[model samples]
Target: MSLQAPPRLLQLAGQSLLRDEAVAIPAVKELPRELFPQLFMEAFTKRQRKVLTAMVQAWPFICLPLGSLMLTPELETLRAVLDGLDVLLAQKVRPSGWKLQVLDLREVDENFWSVWSGAPVSSSLAMSQRQTGEDCPCTGRQGCLKVVVDFCFGFPDIVLQEFLMHVCEWAQQRKELVHLCCKQLVLSVRYVNEVRKFLEMMDLNCIQDIEVHTYREMDSLEQFLPYLIQMKNVRKIMFRHFPGCIYCSPRIGAEIMWELISTFRKLDKLQKLHLDMVNFFKNHLQQLVRFLKNPLVSFTITGCWISESQMDRLFLSPSIHQLKELDLTGTILSDFNPEPFQILLEEVAATLEVLILEDCWITDSQLNVILPALSRCHQIISFNFCGNQISKSVLENLLRHTVRLERLNSVIFPVPLECYGDNFDHIYWERFVQLRAWLMEILRETQALRKPEVILLCTLPCLTCGSRASYDLEPSPCSCGKLGREP
Candidate 1:
């Protein structure tokens, strides 16, 4: 059979029969290793206690996703899953380069953590290597295999505890290599104490990347700052604030924002930093400016409230001049002065290759003030300024300024206000047609230098779906001639 066809096909065929429990129970051993992952999923969903236990013992590789089992209120299925996993850990013979790796502990909540952390391990759980060197299964050198665990909070207490203890036991066996190999840790801020406990249990110094997502309002970040600061070698950091149950409540204070930035300053090897839905105060802008002094390759700040005065210092900073990709989408600056933004554009004209400022409320006056500097952004390859109040003539002039930008390749503009809003019976079709002509003209003019990807979306939000949807306007006689919002 191996000679005639590939093992993957045979594996898929055998697992197809496993859907019928009676047939699978009899032919389980005949299933190939390639079908192991699929069988685990089926057993988990079907609650086939025996099959789940059997597959765990037969699993070829070491990485196990304990969380995928979806710990139910009943512990019977959970016990079967864990017991089968123990057998693999205690196996007498193993593959040459094999060692336990990558245990996923996601959706772990407070209740789950409480039960497992202090639970006693069975003496029978000890593996052959710990008992004697006679039938030692692991031949891989110490520190050869790295273990990465994906942890997310909000699991019930008992389940989370069991998951943590499992990780702790595994780490104990490979004490020397475990920390060196562990790479990334992600935390969601629903329960701060739970996050702290998990961090305390793990070796933070060895981790390379940390991502923290916030859903609730945290009054102070004192508990997380210290452990994060200790991870000096961490290279990438991401902080995103998600709207919580209080839909209208603010996310964080200015002081907290500065403190977060200050925490980032402690890491010398930081390369990429992403902050979303964060508010910035004028006083806190200095901390952000200082953090940018490092030669960062990518900087993204979205849904932030930055005044025109603050934008002035941020854009002219020496750090902005070195960035390769700069994204400032959803940062409201149109309500303030435009001179500062124009100056900042001039400073980054030579270095920035990608610029995104969607939904920033940029108007004709603002575009006019920056047209001279915008033309100098010759290196920009991708540009997006959609969801702003730009008129047809102003946009045409804007294109004329950027026509000579040989490197420019992608552009997405907002529909001019003249053609936006609710207009039935193709009232603005002529204006829309004129806009399309201008776009085609630009393409024809720049055909030799750069063929840019240009997209212009309808300015009005869809009355039905609440999303922007462009209309297919025909030349008055076609079916699309009647294109308009449905009543």
Candidate 2:
């Protein structure tokens, strides 16, 4: 009997022959492609450096898995992977003109990698020390191509050191090209020192947007203060972290909050500021208004607690008087004070085009306070008041005020509850129908005047044992036993 070739060897020979061919592009989108990352991990776990390197070379795109590459059993494999990435990046032609898009180093964590691989930290670092490589192929090529680097929090010191060293190597090889294309940088507050060292290597002037995020409470981020103040061209700055209780840890949160606020002073071109899971107090409120480059165009604060006094100061601040968009979603307006918000609305009526107050616990009295000023906000186009405690009357009045505003287009309102003594009777379906009809009538009249369609979204009521319920769009059963329609 003739001996047949082994099935595994045949597969290997097929892959090898494809690699040797000048145009051996694998199926980039087939179901089998999804197995590549798993195969890479398995190869790393088994200490198969040659197989890993071969896989890296066979990778159709330039998704250089730096973390997995660093885990290779042989230094030659690491070097080979880097060299392969450089070669692929340098090439300009492909069947489809797709290029490398994301360089994800977020997995470069020393402790986690060490624990998962059961390897000593020192040995891993020593083996992974990189040498200066040749320039990137895409370098010096004229194109609008760019890449986004994931440098968020929780990465270990050693990984950051190696990553920054590689970055320095890339910059040294192709300074002008990297400078022209590397306009976006992502940093983390968790690893501040690594962040500082990485920033030291970058040309901060070339950076247009810096996205900084944190996973836990950090005592200080003062290390980034020096570099941030110098990024004059950065038009957008975003600071986001894990959400914390809006009312807890007032003192500790305020200090770090102050440090973050102080950094915004000299950024003259900073037009947009987005803060998430950040705590704010009355004192730190002005730092936002003080951003006087071109009048703070947009400001967003979510999952934060702002005292009534602070809200007062924020709305009345002349710095943001010409602000175009303001969002205070997920903020506790517990005091029910509407003067500051009302004044803020009145001040920016001409320029304030979007206002969002979702989940603010805004009562009918509070809504009533702002109704006059809100109605006068002729430029206000998008308004979201979902997740509040307003009644149907307040909503009707709100629609009446906004109807005359020519720029009004989108409105999101909470579903008014028809409850009696802690039990939800119905969803006030008739009131909602009447409100929608009124809005439609307004739209029809405006259509005669050549206006756009007004989009409205109403929060849904609870059909299951209706107490104060969650958000949906379905109408609930009413005790009145009448269909929600015009008679």
Candidate 3:
């Protein structure tokens, strides 16, 4: 009953151009400036090597976001682009229309391509105007073209590794003409020496985000600290599987901690910090918090345990008072006194947007203690308290309190104990359905305007599949749960 529409005139022309690379290659110089992006996208996606290379050499835009088109690392395409750059560099006098300065190898600028490809003529013109108005930092500097990239050092892809090696060598050959800027760097401990060598060759000041994953490496963190201290412009740092002093002496451990804290002092621009499975900092957290020079916008400490005193010190720290995102997921706080956490909530309530306390084993009494401070967070957009134990009445009270916070959009809560059977592995289906209906009713009655997505999570995983079951304001069960319901 439906018919397929014919291809647009532009699409047919692009296809015809792609059918013959020789003609397309020569026509790039005389082609309309607006057609470059759309045609380049088509050539790049279809792997028209010669045409793609020609377009790169004669590109009219200041930035060529090649990385956006590269969904997977393709060695041949990269080589062709580099070859075009080689031709561009070899020119004694660049073409009048040639404006390429930044070859951004980051997955960005999708809208630029989309607008030029099929958007309205007005949108395409507007995009071209905006691109013309934007200025590059390396604009006027002689022979100072920038090549921006994000590197993940430990990925197990040989083609990607080879592609990066070629790029590195190319940049090294033209160091004066090319500025290789790495914005986000993820380093695995196994490749510390290689990463160090790479970092030494590039400008460290260009790095904005860095993540270090030490997979139980005893001395990797210490070895990397010297290099980390030099990244003064880094805005965020994350440490995962950060080890303790099980393999080294206490004095050596203290020395490493001191070195780390010193590195923190050098990163004055740091605004976000995450430490996951990092038990080594439990004893020195207060000192670390004291050394932070700037107020953090996000601080996440997951899968690590710290004492009540350490938490109290953290709550009192001025560096975290204005936090917008706070995550304490999997950090046991069942034994912690509620006063410190309540105070922390109140301190950050005005700015807090995302608060995740999943798997903290919080009890009904603890929930009650912090509910008042939690309700005052007017900017809270997402709140996750799954894996805590609370009663139906307490959860109802919690929902009622959150109703006044209009910015709340998502809330994940633990299924009340009243919905479970003698043990958590078995669920009372009838009770769960009734309790969920009641909670929905409460939200409908209390919420004046916006209604947040409320999900009830059962901590126990399904016996058939290892996935935990969650109810989204409805009794719809997971696939495994549906089998259990068969009569």
Candidate 4:
């Protein structure tokens, strides 16, 4: 074992100063700029409220990432930091070397701390410049201090909820001097009124990502869209568990769908869109695609049925031509024609990095239609077709095609039909082992530039234990299968 090194002279001196707040508070202004971060980190960690407040008042840096040091939310620590700002604001003459403009309360700036702890100072300066780039709302605004925080409404954490509420109230009280910048906002429809009021209080233009989770009536979304439309800088939007408008009249449902699709036109910077269990967009996909003004990098639609025409319209949309990630997990397509989807694959082959079609129920013939296009996706990194039924011959053909994808690293395919009995309950483990071995041999024979790390053959979940059996280089059976029980 190696002996640990003792603390540096500067660290020991700072600790001694912190032991007496009366001396430390007065010494903060006279202390060297380089010692602030290290000393502040120690003071924050020890919850020395007065020292932290004094350090914040004399902070020399342009951005202080206090949130990074907060491993867990502490109301006293947060209140201490805010109270320092309150003191700083009331001062008639700002302290010399007072460059603090952004107090970021987001969980970031780990690099800032590392660089301050002995790394070159220029590297820390460069990171600070990057963090406070031109996009920063308070970048050159005189006497305006921007406080950045990520608000997650309707979360179950009581302490965090209280902390956020206090921050909101403080920001509201000093609106003229402070700009509350929220880049990411998550809203649960259960607290619709609270979220609405929160959005109204903050600057919406600073928001870049927004997610809405709804388990109630569709009107919750209808009520929330006005606020969403104002977030012009939002790059990603996700709607999860958005209920269908079955309780309303058909005409009223159509109106709500129209309102929802029309709101996308205002989000010119949107690059990623995800809709899960949102059934209202079944026939309105074409209208939605028409409103998207920019190309999308990621698109995900799960557990939503689409008709043949809607599928064709989706593939034909120009916005999806540059997609890097596409996930259609649980979107049934066994009966739909595959020609339109084939065109989409061909269109996005150059840029597509991830493709997931798990539980889509695609047939062998449909897979054949897209195999040529799939083979050309040279940039593909991950591919999943789990829960689809295919014969051994077709699976072999699929593997042969995938061997050409040099960048592919993961491949998850369903076990071939030959390894199963009349139903998925009766899995032929011996046959599965044989087929997996054969497939491995075939992969070895192909000799691609890069082989996938995960080449798994998955089966349906065991009826008894609800565990799935997967065959890779070795077979892993579920508990029921290992016990020779009927599952």
TM-score of 2: 0.60
Candidate 3 TM-score to native: 0.91
CA-only RMSD, every prediction: 10.3, 12.1, 3.5, 3.8
Give the per-residue lDDT of model 4 (tens digit) for 26-62. 9999999878888998898788999998898899888
**Tens-digit per-residue lDDT, 68-115, candidate 3:** 788877889988998899898887787686798778787855666777
Q: Lowest-scoring 10 consecutive residues by lDDT in candidate 2?
A: 126-135
* Candidate 1 lDDT, 1-487, residue by residue in tens: 3566444554456458666877776565566655555566656667888777766555554555454345533456656755665665565565453434434333332222222222344442322122111111232544333344455444356865565556656556655544423346666655667656566666665566677666655653545777778877677777676445444225467666777778778788777666676552334554564674376656777877766666777766665566667787777767767777677678778787988877788889888998898888889888887767788888878767776787877777666777654552233656777777877787688677655655444443444444554532322122332333332
Off by over 4 Å in 2: 1-20, 23-168, 180-182, 214-217, 243-262, 280-282, 291-294, 334-336, 419-454, 460-487
lDDT of 2: 0.57
What TM-score, over all chains together, does every model reach? Answer: 0.68, 0.60, 0.91, 0.88
| lDDT (C-alpha, whole model) for all candidates | 0.60, 0.57, 0.78, 0.82
Better of 1 and 3 by TM-score: 3
* Cα shift from native, residue 231, model 2 (Å): 2.2
Better of 2 and 3 by lDDT: 3
Model 2 clashing residue pairs (backbone): 90-137, 460-472
Q: In model 1, which runs have C-alpha deviations exceeding 4 angstroms?
A: 1-9, 16-85, 88-145, 154-190, 206-217, 245-261, 280-282, 335-353, 372-381, 400-409, 421-427, 460-466, 471-487
In the range 1-487, model 2's lDDT, one tens digit per residue, is 9997554533453344344323322332331543454444455545555555455545543434354345422434445455544554565553253433333332344542342234567554432332111133344455322232333333545655565566556645654434322355666665677456566665566556677765434544555667777777787777676343233323446555666566676677788777776553335766666655567788888777777777777778887778788888888885747888888788888898998988788888888998998878888888888767777677667766666778867777666654212443344545566655665676576554434243444443344432333322344332333322223
Ranking by TM-score: 3, 4, 1, 2
Q: Which pairs of residues have clashing backbones in candidate 4? A: none
